[model samples]
Target chain A: MYIRAAAGISPQSSFEQILADPVPVTGSRLQCMEPDYAKLIDPKMIRRMSRIIKMGVAAAIQCLEEAGERMPDAIIAGTAYGCLGDTEVFLQKMVENDEQLLTPTAFIQSTHNTVAAQIALLLKCHSYNNTFVHRGFSFENAMTDALSLLKDGQMKTVLAGGIDEITDTSHTILKRFGLYKKEPFPAGNIFQTGSKGTIAGEGASFFVLQSEASGNDYAQLTGMDTFYKPASGEEIRQHISAFLERQNINREDIDLVISGENGDMKNDAVYDMVYQTVLSGIAHIPFKHLSGEYPTASAFALWLAANILKAGKLPGGIQTKKTPVTVLIYNHYQHIYHSLYLLAAC
Target chain B: MADLKKQIIAQLNLKDLKPEDIGDDQPLFVEGLGLDSIDALELIVLLQQEYKIKLANAEEGQSVFRSVRTMAQYITDHQGKSTA
Candidate 1:
């Protein structure tokens, strides 16, 4: 299936009117500033949603609006830590209140499948409803499911995407576990060496995938693959080679490579393998520095790749010495999880 | 007043302490009260249900939710100010 329309609401300027113009990271520590969700979400519904759910619904609504449709055949979402803030609130309340007089609001909304379920409820969609929570590969797994359903010819249109939000408690937990650095890095040179932790962020990205291409089709999903274990540089190169080979694509055919190069030293080695061995001499674009590192941050990168394919012009902030992108590959690694998505203009 | 504080704490889901621990002057967010964004929204709902205070703007809520002291003062001041 081809991606018809993609919309994202991220920590950075994703859905704002000024988002077309790039805004570089001004500081090392950055967090997602949520959009005014009441515009896309009903006020009554908006009163009950967590930040993650609100972002997910708003992104889905925007994608549907952009596709000029009111309903989809399926709704799927991938979330690593679903409604962490709400979960924390509920847990805290449960423990503090001794489970006596607990409100059902936070507890009900804290489920991993709450976002997709709420979206289905809002749209009144009784179609295929699924949510994936496979750590870092959540979004990729959801995409794979959406693709398989499309291939089976069961669904004509599907909405698939990922979302995750950061909370103070989660941030502290990750920092204590060495996922992020305690000290801050300068914002201007965040992409350079001496950087420790990727700036924590949160957002949601939704894509309308259809079996048939339309005049407004953004990009065709040519190939998608994911690896579970950490691979050696040689092994990683071979995986990319085999993936492209199956799609009849050679090394020279790829115009741009969007890498998940968060400034974390431990995980940056994965990108080194791809950059040095597989995608040598190709344009490499890194988005984590801009979007900040979240579980499904790769969804935003996919959205960026689709926009690049549709606009046919690489924006300034997204450039990594690449030009005239004919084929775009987004390679991402979150801890032990790795994914590769190949997108082409239809 | 004590019952109102207990209800606010319970509704906001601040599970760490009881109404006695949350002093009237204790802050609600970062240092004193330690509530976050989600808690802020829950507090908004609490205000609507308990005091019938309707705030259309989230920015206007910062001062209105400073602490139990501030919330009690606002409820007292705006008891019959508006229909909403």
Candidate 2:
């Protein structure tokens, strides 16, 4: 499939801005720099939407608008935690009211599929709608589904996206488990922190994809593959090699690699291992500094790679002037959900 | 009644509208307030949690939730009844 257009609400103001100058993530968490929803969604609808829903809907709408599409043939979203703010509200109310007198809005909108359903409702397009909630593999699985539909000729255009939001309750609980770094570090030095925990990141990225090229397409999504819980770093390297071989792409064909290194000592070790062996010496850049570390963060990487491929130049802060024709995105969340995406200039 | 309107606005997340914007007898459903079935349910919870009035019959929701006046009347008649 071809990524005709992409839009993301992330920690940076815009992808262009982030590429020009990497934003400094001073704290352990990187929150999405959201756009004003009043300009994108109706006031009536905005009143009821929680933050995550607003972010997801706004990104989807912006993506469709950029594609010049009124409606997509399908809407598919992947989220590890769905409507988390609403979920927190519902549970809090359930406890406070002792299982009685609970309001319905929070309960109604707390489902994992709410984002996809809300997008469909706003578009008034009664097409295929689905959401994947597989913890680390959520976004990759959603992309797989979109690719299947397009390749099968079942849909011409699909709005595929990955979204996750961080709430105070979730952040606190996750921090207790040591998921984020304890001390603050400059965002640009996330990989150099050499800390035990990575940063917490969240974002919503949507892509308008079609089977055929739109001539102004960002990049052609050649293929993507995922592996879960490989026993060793060698196994991970083999998986990357096998994926590239399956795509009929050689290592030399790839002009750049967007590595998912998030500053955690152990996590960076995994990428370091791969870099030493199979992915050695190729132009590689780390993206977790810009996006923070989340289950669906590879979505941000995909958006970055597509834009980089389309622009044929790396963002200013990275300092590479090479024009890349083929880009590889290799990311694994906590060394469990590993994925590779190959994209080429269309 | 004005307090009830404020409560309703707060509960329903009607941020754009103030209590005074909602007329006492204006329909709170389709035509006037553009609320749906979900908002109706929220209003029911509001009555129970805020006024301690448990709606006796679900069928009566149509009349009790018709307007701010009707809701206030329901609360006035049902408060102190220990429905909870």
Candidate 3:
């Protein structure tokens, strides 16, 4: 399959703006740069919409409009913490009101599949729709299933996306779990922090994928694999090598390597091993500095990787002045879920 | 009934609307306020949460919820009727 169109709403100004210069997070918290959603979302429907729904729906519509498609053959959305704001509201209302009078709107839109279902309803697309929620591997699982659908001749064009939102209350709870830093640190230097936790961030990345490469292709969706709880760094090396070998390529053949390094001193060390051992000589691109940290931050990594393949030049960071032919994307979340995706220039 | 508009605005998160925008006799459905079925459900909660009133059933809900005036009348007529 090929990625025909891609759009991401992150902490940066716009997805296109970050392709060259890294924009320091434009917010105090790692919240997405809210565009004028009034242009994309209906005023009446947006009354009860949380920020996540607005970001997700706007990004999805942007991707489809870029592809010039009114409706996709299938809609698959992957989210780690779906509708976090609404979930918190529903729960807080339950506790505050003694569980007596609760509005059903929040509870209805709190489901993980709400993004996918909303897209389906908006497009009037009654095709195969699914939502995957497997923590860090959520987006990877959705892409894997999308590949299966195309392989089985089920659908030609599929809109696959990853959406996650963060709430202050939920971020506070996650901080209690030691997911975010105890002390305030500069958001721009997140990847350089030698601390225990990284800054919390949220975003939504959407891609319109088709079976064959068309004239509007950004890059070809070559291959992807996911792993859980790999015993050691040596295991990751084995998996990386095997994945490349299946495509009749060598580890060195991959021009650029993109790793999800969120500067968590403990977990990011997992990628350090792979970098030192296998990709020591290979140029690496770090994206979490720009996107912050989230369960599906890897989805934003895909958006960056595809643009790198299209622009040929690796743009700003790193010393790779020449264009890359093949890009390898490796992402790990809290040492539990690890994934690799390969993208070749179309 | 002015309080009702404020309550609906706050509860439903209608960020753009104000109390003066909603007419007391204006219909609350598609033509007047452009509220959907979900907003209607939210209105039901708003009524119970604000006033001590319980709509007997869906059949009676239509007449009571026809307009802000009608809703205020229902609340006034059943001031002593408490659902709690």
Lowest summed-lDDT stretch of 10 residues in model 1 chain B?
B9-18
lDDT of the structure predicted as candidate 1: 0.79
i-RMS for every candidate: 7.6, 0.6, 1.0
DockQ for every prediction shown: 0.04, 0.91, 0.84
Off by over 4 Å in 1: A15-21, A26-28, A317-325, B1-84
DockQ agreement of candidate 3 with the native complex: 0.84
In model 1, residue pairs whose N, Cα or C atoms come closer than 3 Å (at least 3 residues apart or on different chains), thus clashing, are A11-A32, B27-B33
Please give me the DockQ of candidate 2 compared with the native complex: 0.91
Error (Å) of candidate 1 at residue A169 is 1.1
- TM per candidate comes to 0.78, 0.98, 0.95
Which pairs in model 3 have colliding backbones? none
lDDT of residue B72 for candidate 2: 86
Worst 10 residues of 3 chain B by lDDT: B75-84
Clashing pairs in 2: none
What are the per-residue Cα lDDT tens digits for candidate 3 across A138-203? 999999988899878878999999999888898888889988877655656765668888778889
Best by TM-score: 2
Deviation of model 3 at A99, angstroms: 0.9
| Model 1 chain A worst lDDT window (10 residues) | A14-23
